[model samples]
Target chain A: MRQILHILTQPNDPLAAKIIAAQRQEPDHQVRVADLTVPEADYHALLQEIFSSDSIEVW
Target chain B: MKPSWLLIITSDPRTSARPAEAIRIAAGVGTWKKADVSVYLRGPAVLALSEFADEFIDEDNYTRYFPIIGEFGRPIYVEQGAPRLAEIGESPMRYQEISDVELAALAARHNHVARF
Candidate 1:
């Protein structure tokens, strides 16, 4: 299944690391990680992409 | 540095950690940047000021950082008619009560405005 993981955290945050590890275990799921903490990240655009996907989980 | 900043946070910390984190970052940045920072809480965001805030989140402990932000002298305000104000008893931190009209006026006076 296509899944989008939207994480509103810094690049090096521990929570973000844990999320990346968890996503790796689900190899069958097509996952995209959007980090909102990045200065250049456009949250509205990312939200649009995530809402259009099959499934979305925010952290 | 900007003269003032208005950070309007409408997200409930119980539902997500982003709102609390946004408040923390905004307050810190505003303080360090020497701008007069004001936080306006509306909707569920008022919960961030409650003593029970720590119980809702397991990670990121955003409630703990709230006091540090307050120490910077950045004022935090809650909407006068926000429903969450009734849900969560007395606030642990200091905040002024402002009506929706006053919130708009506050925003208008600030040089920069951000919403989360």
Candidate 2:
């Protein structure tokens, strides 16, 4: 399984939604979406997780 | 030695005053703190360059603060592709136009970056 991380800076960003939908269609991909509009500590933790993932996309 | 800082202000003053206030205070205090500062206005933040900026009179009046920033010998840059750029052609205030690549280069040159 491929691990994919999506870092979205804006709330309800359309691009992030589209990417999530596309990844959901792929059965072999595990996709996670991290909204960067959160608190700084939460954002750092999410970033750390993204660094550990197989692939990452930022929007 | 003072550290160089890139202050990227991308918030719309129409929506909230927090971002404008943040830039105002940063530029105001950063100068006395002896930090070399640069400002880049992008997105809705470019609207701050319009003549309408003078009408913005709050307790922190960002319009007034901007000139103080310039007096501190800090270079202010406006993004070439900012939506409001054409509406306010040739800002009365001292600012240079920069492309996305140039903006990236400026950020890379700075020791630290703060985005509003």
Candidate 3:
């Protein structure tokens, strides 16, 4: 399985949802999403995800 | 070795929330001791480095990421000839002014580049 990380820069962006949903459909892809727009987001954990993921998509 | 991540901010901060978000990301990513993170401000986004940055911050989503970013102490890069450069005055952030060509080289040197 491939680790896929999705970094969201915008709030409520349909594109992010659409892309993540499509990625989830792939049986071999393990997807994770991080929304940076949240006031209390833990960026440190997000960085860990970013570095560990085989694929990263920013939206 | 840690991978270098460069965040390029070119949006108009006053008209958009992108600049603040980019900075927030930089601050968050900076916390990871293993990731080499840097920020590059060009165009109107350069304004975010100045004292005027307070005006562009999205208060609702802001967590005062500047101090965090500052504490990380990476040299932020600001492009020369940004629009209204004179009006912005001195920036509290430590930045080095680089030309467009230098910007290209800087981006090329990074392992990952994200533009906002």
Candidate 4:
């Protein structure tokens, strides 16, 4: 199963692209990002997706 | 250097992308201590590299946000985000060539990813 790492919350333009460059480890991983205008539901879904993973912790 | 968590974004997320009650807490420097800062700029926010820059339309021409960052002493980087800023010219920040493959990899490396 492929897991998605949601960095979408962190990117707002160049940063999103930058984060896209810096993160992610293996092939089965995915990174999602957003901009000035992202739907609330979509954002929440990203977090929920992570929680379903082996574990989800925000520090 | 402080234990930085990696700040990968173009403009100040607080003022540029996400607008909150002005209190999401940055990773040190301004009001906090023990915060290591490493910012990377790319995409649209890259435009912020020149954001809020003082342009002396009077002088030949100079409009960019680097001067402010320099004063603030924040270590920021610009990659493809630089070329997106202008057609051509030297930007104050250094540019890093990023790819989808690279971005995906970075997301997994950081402890957390918070876009503004």
Candidate 5:
């Protein structure tokens, strides 16, 4: 499965979120969200993992 | 050079000072740390493109550091969405309008991403 990273900054940007979820639902891809707009406590760790991973596709 | 910073210029002209500060940061960091810096024009930042030949020549003008973008071995990228700014028209550099998804991917490719 491909690990896709999405940095979502807009609450209005459902497309971005939906894409990530779709990827995750399918075995072909797994979506991880950074939730950049309102960075949560774990956002930094999530970002570090995604950025450090080579198999991750960021959007 | 390590990698480029996807600099976004989306602030108003009166608020151009904010971008100027960002430019200065790029110049200083690129010069000292050998950073590959790339400026991306988005939203209101597209206005910087049209200011190409204006008072941009002033050293005190924050734009003076813009040339440093190229000097430091970085490309000044413009958004393709901003139709008003064309290299031939008024904006000094070329622009590309990429999807927000693509922008995110770009930010991902870089080692560090900072927004201003």
Candidate 6:
């Protein structure tokens, strides 16, 4: 399965929700979400995820 | 080798300060870092580099950093299906139109990717 990273810059973004929902159902994908707007988000870890993920979506 | 940084600006400048901040960050990275920095424009952010770009300025941060960005002379890549694609024709800045497939490849190649 391909690891897909979803980076969210907006809180409760509807489009991001829709895309993540559809991707979650795919058999060949493993989805991970990182919310950048949140206070607890670790920038270094997120940067590591950005380079490691097979696919990335910023929304 | 210098790390490659891909800065993607997808926010609508007229509606939010994200695009302006994105531009400022791009400029900062280009100016201060010993890295290869490139910008990608798509969605509403494409308009931020158009001839009517002045209209989209956040007024809060864009006005101060727009000129600084020019000093770096980094290539600004615009997505093929971006909104207001026509308005960006022959932009004074170094602008290149690219495909979504290419954009994906670009992000993969970059050492870091930041989207706004």
Global lDDT of each model? 0.64, 0.67, 0.72, 0.42, 0.55, 0.73
State the lDDT of candidate 2 residue by residue for B1-116, as single tens digits: 67666777777777767557866776677758687777888877787776656444342466667677777665679888766887765565777888765664455455555566
TM-score of each: 0.59, 0.61, 0.62, 0.44, 0.60, 0.64
Between 1 and 4, whose DockQ is larger? 4
- Candidate 3 matches the true fold with a TM-score of 0.62
Query: Which lDDT value does model 4 have at B111?
Result: 45
Runs of candidate 6 exceeding 4 Å displacement: A1-59, B60-64, B70-74
- In the order shown, the candidates' DockQ scores are 0.02, 0.06, 0.04, 0.22, 0.15, 0.15
lDDT, candidate 5, equals: 0.55
Candidate 6 at residue A33, lDDT?
91
- Write out the backbone clash pairs for model 3: none
Candidate 6 lDDT for residue B78 = 83
Deviation (Å) of B95 in candidate 5: 5.3
lDDT of 3 by residue, A1-59 (tens): 76777778889966346546766766776878889999988899998997887656565
Off by over 4 Å in 3: A1-59, B57-63
On residues B1-116, what C-alpha lDDT tens digit does candidate 4 reach at each position? 44334445534432343311111234223334454434455655554444333322211112222333344354454454345568334555544555555544544544444443
Query: Per-prediction RMSD in angstroms?
Result: 14.0, 8.5, 9.9, 8.1, 5.5, 5.6
Residues B1-116, model 6: lDDT tens digits: 77777777877888878888888787787777697778888888887775545667565455566666666665678877766877666555667788765665566556566777
Highest TM-score: give the candidate number. 6
For this target, which candidate reaches the highest DockQ against the unseen true structure? 4
Rank the candidate models, highest TM-score first.
6, 3, 2, 5, 1, 4
By lDDT: ranked, best first: 6, 3, 2, 1, 5, 4
Give the least accurate 10-residue stretch of model 6 chain A, judged by summed lDDT: A14-23
When only chain A is evaluated, what TM-score does every model earn? 0.60, 0.78, 0.92, 0.36, 0.60, 0.91
Q: Candidate 4, which CAPRI tier?
A: incorrect
**Local accuracy of candidate 1 as per-residue lDDT tens digits, A21-44:** 555555554556677777888878
Backbone clash tally for model 3?
A: 0
lDDT (tens digit, per residue) of candidate 5 on B6-115: 55555554445666676777777777655566666665566655545353323254457666655755456655566545433554444456655565555545554454
Q: Report residue A14 deviation for candidate 3 (angstroms).
A: 27
The C-alpha stretches of model 1 lying farther than 4 A from their native spots are: A1-59, B58-61
